[model samples]
Target chain A: MDVQAFKQRILPVQGRLFRVAQLFLRNREEAEDALQDVMLRLWSNRQQLETYQSLEALAVQMTRNLCLDKLKAHSRQKMATDGDFPEVQATTATPYQQVEAADSNELIHRLMEELPDQQRFILHLRDVEEYSFEEIEQLTGLSVNNIRVILSRARQRLRDSYTKANDYEADY
Target chain B: MKPTIEKLLEKYYDGETTLDEEKELRAYFQQENIPAHLQSHAPQFRYFANARSEHPSLKSINALANRLNAPEPNWVVRMGSWSVRLAASIGLLILGFGGGLVYNQLRPSAGKGTDLSFISETAPEKSLKQTLAFEQLAKTSASERIDAINQSYEITQADQEITQLLLNTLNFDSNVNVRLAACQALARFEREPSVRDGLIQSLKVQTDPNVQITLIDVLVTIKERRAVEEMQRLAENQEALDAVRLKAEEGVQSLNQAGNAPS
Candidate 1:
């Protein structure tokens, strides 16, 4: 495909690709690099890009694979040892409530980090990006039922972890 | 949490919720007024919504596009071959002209310069072969090619090759410094109509503000009345750099004055 065609077709989906990368790698710079690399690969293959059923799904799949290939072991190690995932602000609460809100935000990210990679990615695609089950299935090469099961398990795991953290905080 | 939301949340974590029900669960958690016990789950919904807002920079997007969509390999190979042939022919033409100029310089007393006759008598076929050899050097050293063009500039009174090189350089060289230097050299040969036209054309297409301003300055100094309209258009363009617009405005005024004055 020519550049303008590629830009119109694929460039607009970069944010989704970046977010997926961020979800997988949990580092903004690493995610940015992964997205850039994926975009370059997509561009080189643009001549055949249009034949794909969903460019967005393909891009997301590429970003996921790139980040998964290079995700740092230390990040996984850090999550287990320190429960530190990068800071993410998910609320517009007042400063009075922001401390509590931010704590939960970090907790959610950490919980996801602790989940199995497939479950984490499945939940992210469905919950965050809001891709349909069929779309997620096509991207992930999983059945719709498998996606539902993984996402359900991922949410339950998140709830269990959040409860444990809350209990620990209360004990302190 | 509301009883309905409680039911949806339960269905949500049980692998039994439909997409719509899951969205409802997400919406319920997104609110600020969820029961304190369920507040920790709010971020999971919030993360999804916030992550959607992430955007990579436009610079990275364009860089990827440029790198990946570079000219096709066959086109590059074809252009390389064409350029080599063109450069070879141009080199021979310049060498033949340079030899004639040197011969003229040595033969001030016509037919009295026997010492250098052998050098000037090199066969045209040999020069063609030498030109092919020089073409190899030209591909290796762009600086050498530029130097050859510069040497041609010295003999501009005899031919158009120098002006052609200068015009090509001004219009197409990727290096701003080379184009800037070419603009300066073109000023010396402003008597050439091609140089005058090239300056105006370059003004219209050149992206560099420095080159635009220089082209305007040269056109104004030469009083090329034809450039006034292009300069006016450039001056009025909002996207043109401030200095370039100002220089273009000045060029139009000076060209108008030069037009009104009697010879």
Candidate 2:
């Protein structure tokens, strides 16, 4: 896109881009960094964005791919900025106790850490973002059936980890 | 009735599922009946799809974009630095030249040098009278030369400069003709009180016996009877070498006979 068009059109996506960056990076500065980086990438390839049928999906994919690259770069730089703002690592505890605690939300978030990255990733696309199996297949290059099986198996794993140890479902 | 986990896995892999089928998969994992062995991996499926929605403010993005796209100021900046370097080099050149000028003004100019040669070439030509007068005195008696020396003697400042020049030239002139002329010119000064002192100095220290013999001849010719005692002293000195001592003795005898001879 021309400079004028790129500035006008892609500038609005800055919010969404930072959000995607924050999801992967989990911090303010890194999110900003990721937003700017993705903006620059999108601005540079604005012509490709014009050809895409789904602006939201493409932008989402672009932002997430950029976020992935940013994470890789963060790892390559030898210091993860994800928790620089103040984050506690998953503490030493069995999953049962972690789920039973009052911080069960954080506990659920922590469970994502234990899952194989692809399993967690498929579950996230399917359940959280509500992308269809076809979209997941497109995003991950996995077959639609493979996306389903992976999502199903991943859900089973989640149920097994978060279920109360005594087989009861009442409040802790 | 639903199949177990294996059946669910098979249906998922076969791409056969309703909305209820997916909900069942989620419920199956969310249920309390999951065995202990599989419980550890459960929340890996927390459907984190909505997590990427955080954002920075619009103001911050605009500020960052402005910083990234900032352009430098115009040519004045780049040319201005080069101009400073050029000015400094010129200033140093001028400073060095001024220092050299001051140093030259403070130092003495040796007489025989390129500056004198340049001055001589560039200075106005001398008047005809000054030239002829210089030539005539240069060929005249020492007393005449002494009278003529300082008339235009801006170039040299030695005391008794005329006598010094005559004596030096008489000793070094390659032409026997010039040597004879210098001797004849100095002959008159042999009796002058100052030239007599210079002649005595030449007799005492001069190693050239020929010049010594000629000086003796001039002393006798001029009847500088005052030099007799000095010649007699040189004659008796043991340090006087053979030929020079003999010349000194001859000079003394000539003076003695001249002193005693009738008028």
Candidate 3:
């Protein structure tokens, strides 16, 4: 984990780290924060690289854990502010009313904005990151059954929601 | 018994299936003969396995590489810092937020000492309060005094509270490019074990779809096997969002390749 080697090793994964941040925090700044924070830890803990059988796996573990911590802190901070922060608006998109301008993808994002945080969390990890049931179980502390049931329902809801949202739009 | 699609799907996420089983499952998914009831599940299942198949945005990666790769330039940095400071001061004067204010505002923060000067210049409204003493000293009314405080001493207030505060302010930055840049600059820090943990936590939970996609890309590049596992687990979770699960699957495939690569 010398400096240059570390850089080369992680350069391959930088995109991954940012993607994790983006997916979880839902904000580029937060994603970058997550990315930098993860990198800083990796740089400082160069000595501990030998502890894991796979450094890349270890890096993923580290990122997931870091994101969890950040998310918790963020929630706590948000509670402390008595809802004064404008963070909610940034994350929660207003459903666009105009049919012509609203694409299916945009409708989907809008629908996603309305789902409970927990469901969204599980869905992204399963579909986007493509972790295993056991892997998801390990990260979120949920059982494999719980993960599977949740994912099945999430897609159904998305397909339904997508259809329902654009029912009146004239199909081309 | 030889593996069937169901068995492979059962262990698909846990990494239990052999490489061959995975291929078989993918092949089954790609075929047109799946039962009608199972047809919907077909895409979802194929999606989880194929999730890792997505590519990430390279433009941002290249910029990140340039930053990480450009040697520290310490000696040059040491020598140039003095001139850079002087030149920056003159440039600030030309730009005229006052030399000190612009200088304080423009310098990249080290996340340690408070940049009161920068705060005073940038976040004056948040930094200033309507003190009775200030009211007495001023010729203005209470409302006017508040207005003056708001206008004159708008400090950005970098303090012990900065990490949280700056992290919060970072979200609403009017300039998307600056927001993106801050995100890029923060990538270096993922290397720390604690920050690494913090990042993982954030990625697991944050709700913004746009941001979620970005995180998936990072995981792919980092190739963290466990994070890949976490993502797969989420995909398997019935409660997980469709978009998020999809992103997780893509991340997993990317990491699988990176992880299982020929060394």
DockQ of 2: 0.22
Worst 10 residues of 1 chain A by lDDT: A78-87
Best by TM-score: 1
Top-lDDT candidate index? 1
Per-residue CA lDDT of candidate 3, range A1-172, in tens?
6668887787677666665655556555566667767776786677787676656656766777887788887663321211221222223334451221233333444555456666766666655565566666766678877777776666567656655655555363
Give the residue spans of candidate 2 off by over 4 A.
A7-16, A44-104, A132-134, A164-172, B1-53, B56-120, B123-263
- Tens-digit lDDT track for model 2 on A1-172? 6666766766766766565555566566767877776766666577677897766567667778877887786574423333321123234545664445324444455555456767877766666555777777777788987787787777666655656422454454
Model 1 DockQ reads: 0.35
Q: What are the TM-scores, per candidate, against the unseen true structure?
A: 0.53, 0.39, 0.37
Please, what are the lDDT tens digits per residue for candidate 1 over residues A1-172?
A: 7767887888788888987887777766666788889988887787788789889988888888888778653445332312222334444667666676656666676777889989888888887777888898899899888888888898899888888887898898
Residue A138, model 3: lDDT of 68
Residue B189 accuracy (lDDT) in model 1: 83
Give interface RMSD for all predictions: 2.3, 6.1, 7.7
Candidate 1's residue-wise lDDT over B1-263, tens digit each? 47787787778787677778777877776677889756666777766665556666566667666665565665687899899989999999999999999989878766555435545433332232232242354453445444544554455362365566667777876667667777887888888888888888888889899899888888888889999999999999999999889988988988898888865
Sort every candidate by lDDT, greatest first: 1, 2, 3
1 or 2, greater by DockQ = 1
List ranges where model 1 is wrong by over 4 Å.
A72-92, B57-263
RMSD of 3: 52.2
On the 0 to 100 scale, the lDDT of residue B20 in model 1 is: 84
Candidate 3: tens digits of C-alpha lDDT, residues B182-223: 233334444444434434554666455555556566555655
